[model samples]
Target: MERLLVVLCPELLEEQEDGRAARTFAGVVEVVESFSPAAGAVRPGVCAVPTRGPSRYFGGDVRLAGLVRTALSRTDTALGRVEGHIGVADGLFVAVLAARAAGDEPVVVPAGASARFLAPWPVEALERPELADLLRRLGIRTLGAFAALPTRHVLGRLGTQGSVCHELARGMRSELPGYRLVPRPHPATAATGDGSAGAQVRQAGFWGEAAEAEARAERALGHLEQLLPPDGVAVGRLQGGRGPAERARLVPWGGRRLDPAGPGPEPWPGQLPAPAPASVLARVPASVVDGRGAELEVGPSGLPSAPPEQLSVRGGPWQPVTAWAGPWPVDERWWSRRKRRRRARMQLVTSCGMAYLVVREDAGWWVEGAYD
Candidate 1:
């Protein structure tokens, strides 16, 4: 589960008739956004930000929480003074509880301690009133007691909803039902022209349609970054190679900047034709045989001893080959003795209408890729 930092305002949880709570919370979100662009409003008076990157940048989780608390202190809101409670923990459910528990100092739950920290909490913390009542009647009044029930028995006796709660009790899932909300745009800041209290004036041309599109893209990316592990997101760059897997490589998406488009695919000698395979697979042992049920071989001259008539993958039943393409021989790094590779590749369509890219090295055959 991803570690999260939550900011909760008890006073602003419920909106007022004048909409002061929502506008105040939006200001709180803006303050949190200064620390991490991935910060998002979970509700009117609640917000969360993934702490992985920011914690490292600010030295540690304790320091990061302190900085966030200090920054939120200076934010002016319609409610006169903003009171933000900060907490850090793994997953959203426990993190929100941690925020509520915080007072003058931010609460930081140590890593890998979510289950232990949640064990003492009441079953009501799960927020399912029916489940909590049933568990209490069964003598399971605490999270630890509820989690101790056998998972299979829980599923069989209580059905899917109970199974979901079981996972939450065991600290397996990150969020509770309805914990995350799609953030709505702030009505005050989105207003323009009249120069109202929080109105943001917009200019034309470069800051018009293109700028709005870019801002939307950035927000989408920020939300994506929050869900993924630190540095987990990447973009693929195509390069010259013989096989589909080698023709492209994944590079980390750094600094939240998109690279300019590159030139399209270029012709390379011995490379496969256009319309590459849809999926690249690990080296799966396969069998390629002739009509006589004899294993086919690719001789030293890079020519097959006999035409392939059947193919079997991972010891599965053999499927008849309906159509086939050339044995494109690749002899790379020939100058280096240990680094050299000599292999033959062929594209074949099976009787089941599945297409595969199979390779032969020495006397062994393997399925390297598949076509949609």
Candidate 2:
């Protein structure tokens, strides 16, 4: 788990139509960057700095916190009366809670004391509603209680997600799911009045070997750009949606480069669980049938008429469905009679060892995508 110092400004969390919060938060990030060059915005009004280096330079975590708070106080009157809460802990998750618990002074959880510091927090602090509800029902209301449960039992009961949360409760993991946002360049290092080309020229390479590798990669990309048509070079950018296809878009390269390694889109209400499919295909016609070779269909209640037995893509020979999950219903634009849509999606694994995502509409089944 990486030790982090979280800076949260309650006043600048919510964005207004005028984007005042964003601008104010940018100023806050700038101030923190002055202390540590690695400070990054986790979200609007929430930023984190890796404390290892900065703590050493500033004499210690406590003194570092005090110095930051003093600096922020000096900027409050100039930058819309900002109230900053600082917390230093072993991980991002606990550090955020420490920040929230802070008052006028910074909260510093001792090194190697993350589990003890987190023991008293509610299981709800894990921010997983379904798991929290289950734990509450099982009389496991506190993080300590959840952590005490046998790992095998938790994994058996809740699967991978439960195991992950259990690790968090035990302080084995530092970050909460979705805590990271896409990395946006700091305003000071971003494109200046000179041009976007200046931004590209300012590559980040901490070592000589890495710098040489980056230069080689840049040269290769430059050659590729000259060889390929403008539309041939593209990259994927994430967007908000429930399905893999809807959540990503392919944009022409040489614009803003979005890091694929960054965190995914924020969780959507009806989104499929992760390990997203490896490929998203156009809606291709497919055939699905039950054991008796009867076509399967989804009813108005979104339940399948019969269990899926086999699938055939584009009239290909049927492959036996070895496993399947879901009739995850889609009811969009429900308030509007004319625009309302009703559909269901299912994951099917065939005997050929291939998995596919298929959707059922009023017309019939269509293959939406496939998994690796």
Candidate 3:
């Protein structure tokens, strides 16, 4: 019912790791939905977490803030003097602005007094360079000065961003509807036969779906044996059959692309460097049928196609798509959009990290999924 405590590390922008550290940092606060990079190199990390649960569980917001401080400060040495600061306010945007202002040191805006606390700060507190410049040109240097200016003039001059800057400069935050995080299951959708024969066969989910797909792709790409590095190293990954495709979003909304080279605490491949996190597509079943009619059924034989047009997934920094199945065509009613189903479809996954399926609608072939 109160404000969420936001913890920040200005220097965190320099830490070149995956999103895990940034996510873990938000976990220090509450449920971490996702982390967004403001600008330069995904650095300048900012995490948003709910405060009610932590404040209640920890007895109070002040204590919760202290706990966050302890968690962030308790890190490995040699990371340099990276200070983690905590700021508490009525909302996330305000807390972020306040946290940025109190850099390298902790500060908590008193409950219900966020507006008062932000009144004296500079217009740059909102961090919009262009808007800040415009405001300065208009002689509005401080939050108090901006607040004194008319809202109509603000909006007319700067558009929506101006309205946002004004609201945030006054400790007001845009209300974001709360949403839930969907779970991403590992990819290995394998079909294994029973010890006796086909009728007794069963398919078990593999532990590492990404690796399996990658291996399958690498094997399929054996045709390019000479192109492969002597070490069988891979270049990148693909999401559909041998040909190019498009993307589709199902029940799960937005996905966090893991940057192997981004700001994470742990190194990828243990000591070896890793690539930055990027967006991955989710592989969702377009249609389902009885076992007898399943395309890539629970049996071992997944959808396999000819060598030329087959898309393979290879692992390394990128992957390739080897084979494809389905167009086991399906169509479903889009409840939200209230649209009737019309496209034919199938699924594709490659070794590296791309997961997709093709829609054979009149529009030709289009991709519909990628796993994160």
Candidate 4:
């Protein structure tokens, strides 16, 4: 693979938005023979350019990086001091991380040493929060340990995502999975007379599991309601399931039918923005039934408070459940000596037919949320 140089603007967002980043990036592009934005933006905070042409024009990778930095320094002083870190490595993933670690100086990972270069970093550096959490629970603390895992086993548990992380740990070519919001094209490049040029679309996925993929799709759709213009609507099919064949039409979410009487807890006045509608509680107290079917009440301190009969929400009135599901167990972050969570969740319907997600963690059982 050709050595790729990654240029990262450490504080692009803090810089003036009136073309400062673009002008600086355009300067680098003028100097570098060939380059591409890693993502869709003209001046993405991070970009990769092949090092061959620039290295040959200058003395070497180090000299090429210095030249690019000098170009940026001269490009725009209106934005005040703008500095970038450059990393030269074999692949985009390592190159990006290397640039981040480079901090004002250019760092070059020797060709064929990308894997070794990445091995010492913590697995958390992978940046896929979910996959990192799973790895932590499995006792994989560092990239080297994760790289040592059998590929087949990682695939079986994490699916395509696991495979991607594994490849990164080994410093191989791999596509990062998950949703990415694409920015609109720069006005100078946008063509006239076509509404299509401004039409926006949000893309997400390539998830390994059907359920998780569907959940993410639903969350994405819910968010659109807030993102769209007042009179605008998004029209497209959510495509997933086994292959390209299975797809579902997008529709307004008519939330769960279970409407509880009166209102639940109102937001106690606060400056914090309301939590995202789909966020799950980090900790919740609940009435749990173990694998042996023994019922127990978990309290505010996350300790068993009483037998099943006395179980109730931490501070709410005792409401009887009409039906209940299993005590499905979940254990996460077990590798972290202090952050492990061993818990189980249950689906329950109250006497009024309202459903709730309740969880029992080491901290104790609590209600996660209402079904609706």
Highest TM-score model number:
1
| Model 1 lowest lDDT segment of ten | 198-207
Task: Please provide, for model 3 over 72-124, each residue's C-alpha lDDT reduced to its tens digit, 9 standing for 90 to 100.
Answer: 66544344334666677776556666676666555777777766877888887
lDDT of each: 0.77, 0.78, 0.45, 0.56
What would the TM-score be for candidate 1 when compared with the true structure? Answer: 0.54
**Model 3 ranges off by over 4 Å:** 17-44, 75-82, 103-105, 174-372
Where model 4 places Cα greater than 4 Å from the true spot, the runs are 14-43, 74-76, 174-372
lDDT (0-100) at residue 298 of candidate 4?
Answer: 48
TM values, all candidates: 0.54, 0.49, 0.38, 0.44
lDDT for predicted candidate 4 compared with the true structure: 0.56
By TM-score, how accurate is candidate 3?
0.38
Count backbone overlaps in model 3. Answer: 47
Q: Cα lDDT for residue 345, model 2?
A: 94
Error in Å for residue 324 of model 3: 62
Candidate 3: C-alpha lDDT: 0.45
Name the candidate, 2 or 4, with the larger TM-score value.
2
* Tens digits of lDDT, candidate 2, 62-171: 99999989888888533577999999998777888889889989999888787788889998888778989999999999999888888658745764457667777777
TM for candidate 4 is 0.44
For residue 113, model 3's alpha carbon misses the true position, in angstroms, by 2.0
